[model samples]
Target: MKAKERRNNIKNLLINSSNPIKGQELAEKLGVTRQVIVKDIALLRAEGKKIIATPEGYLVTKNQENLITKIIAVSHNVEDIQDELETVIKFGGIVKDVVVEHSVYGEIKAMIMIKSLYDVHNFMKKINKGKGEPLLVLTGGIHLHTICADNDEIMDNILSELKNKKYLIY
Candidate 1:
């Protein structure tokens, strides 16, 4: 298939699928190298496609008309990461991203997109396998998360749970 046709197919696939599609999977489907898919994704983004690269794969950003988004400050030890994420998901919140203030960079953010226990497990596995440090380490375990939920009540419940666990910064 031509490059333009392949990109259009990719866009269609992303739009129709709810889950993030891995580059390797896309490459296999397109009979191309994973690098090609990466480049295609970059080109798509250049054209103003709202594609987000999550740990699992690539997905188009969905409209948030009915969702409530809030930034919450949290602090916890590295070991408590799972519990913190679980609390948010349990209260119906999707942890969209984690942000931290960096002395040099000012602010750094990572797309988390953790919405379930499965996502949390995969996230922790990736971190452990890569020996990756959480961005919270940059600021002594203090960070902010952009969480989205069905409504204000769900977000409030998430915050209440985090507060009970002493994870909320305030």
Candidate 2:
């Protein structure tokens, strides 16, 4: 296939996939190397495709009609981090990212990319084993998470639960 045709096919496949498309998978489909696939993705991005490369893989933003995203402010004891994320996930919200107010760096943001209990557990375990200290403990358990859902009601339900537990800020 020609370069332009391959690039277009890659873009279309990514745009339709609900999950991340790995470079290897894309290359296998195109009969090319993963390096070529990566370059094609870069070229597609330069052409204004909103492709997000993540640890899992690359995903096109799925901006469907019912998509709703919001940043929820939450406060908790550092030890309750798992409980907080579990609550969010149980209520159907994907914890996409975390943001914290820094003393010198202004607002600092990190992608949590947590969508399930397993992800939360693995993340905490890695932190415990690799890091000197958990980052959440530095902020007194006060943080913001960007969550996404299919409707406003899911977020409302999650926020209501947060408020009930005194975790919601305003």
Best by TM-score: 1
What does each candidate score in C-alpha RMSD? 1.6, 3.6
**Tens digit of lDDT per residue, candidate 1, span 69-138?**
9899999988899999999999878999999999999999888899989999999997778768889889
Compared with the true structure, model 1 gives a TM-score of: 0.91
Candidate 2 stretches greater than 4 Å from native: 1-13, 16-18, 21-43, 131-135
Query: What TM value does model 2 have?
Result: 0.69
Q: Kindly give the number of clashing pairs for every candidate.
A: 0, 0
Q: lDDT value for candidate 1?
A: 0.92
